[model samples]
Target: MTDIFNKIETSFRASLRGEESTDKLIYVWGIISYVLAFLLNKLIKTVHVYFFGTTISAVLICYFAWHIYALKKCSPKKPKLTKEEKQKLREEKRKEFGKKLMRKLLLQESFTKWDPIFISIVIDAFCIAQFIDYIIR
Candidate 1:
């Protein structure tokens, strides 16, 4: 567990250093999606695998978001905004946050992550298959 976290933390720092989080992030979530998918396949007997899937998907979204936020909070930093621009930026962020929250809540199959679209597609396809199988069975 600590090792997993340490790896992600290292990657997170690398991202702050202007490095990409491609393998670091996608591999981490790929492992997560695999384990979670396997568990849901064998253990969970819920009606909607998407329920657990969506929850875990939201966790991944939040993980990336929090990592970005932490990076922004730590690095070279940005120029201080003027009062007007600050308010506008804050409001824009609030709106964007609401939209993302809605997307996760809706379990939108069309959604894609900024960092890893293919990975998100693969994970979602696996989850959706589990869900459809549950319904079919």
Candidate 2:
């Protein structure tokens, strides 16, 4: 029992190490939770709603919580440029590609970074709605 608990603690700490680990942990817990929920719903044949609802909610909560932690912990890198360097780059871009193209490129760069976070937020919202439905029904 002590060995088992120690192993679990080690695994949990490793999962907290980075975004990748948290992401993998989310998938693992989601699958495990769903399987347990299904087993309880099928075998016990009672309290199915409770088991399924709680399991789903717990998984979502775990995912979102870890996601927020990962986001907070991993700070975005600062732009490596002085004011003069930035001005030179802006002038060069304007001369080479025009201001309109520069704006588009910047937008695309930011969008790529933000896209996953936006999608995850939408998913979290959907999960919350489903959890509410599970509770009400």
How high is the CA lDDT of each candidate model? 0.58, 0.56
Separately for all candidates shown, the number of backbone clashes (residues 3 or more apart, or on different chains) is 0, 0
Record all residue pairs in model 1 with backbone atoms less than 3 Å apart, i.e. clashing.
none
- lDDT by residue (46-95, candidate 1, tens digit) is 43565675565455445545444433443343698899999999899998
Weakest 10 consecutive residues of candidate 1 by summed lDDT: 68-77
Model 2: ten consecutive residues of lowest lDDT: 108-117
**What digit string (tens of lDDT, one per residue) describes model 2 on residues 1-137?**
99989976776565566423534444554346445545633543455767665676566556556545553344344589999999999888779676656667778433234544445445555555655555566
Can you tell me which runs of candidate 2 are displaced by over 4 Å?
Answer: 1-51, 96-137
> At residue 56, what lDDT does model 1 achieve?
52
Give candidate 1's TM-score.
0.31
lDDT of 1: 0.58
| Candidate 2, number of clashes | 0
- lDDT of model 1, residue 94: 90
Model 1 residue runs over 4 Å out of place are: 1-4, 10-19, 46-120, 125-137
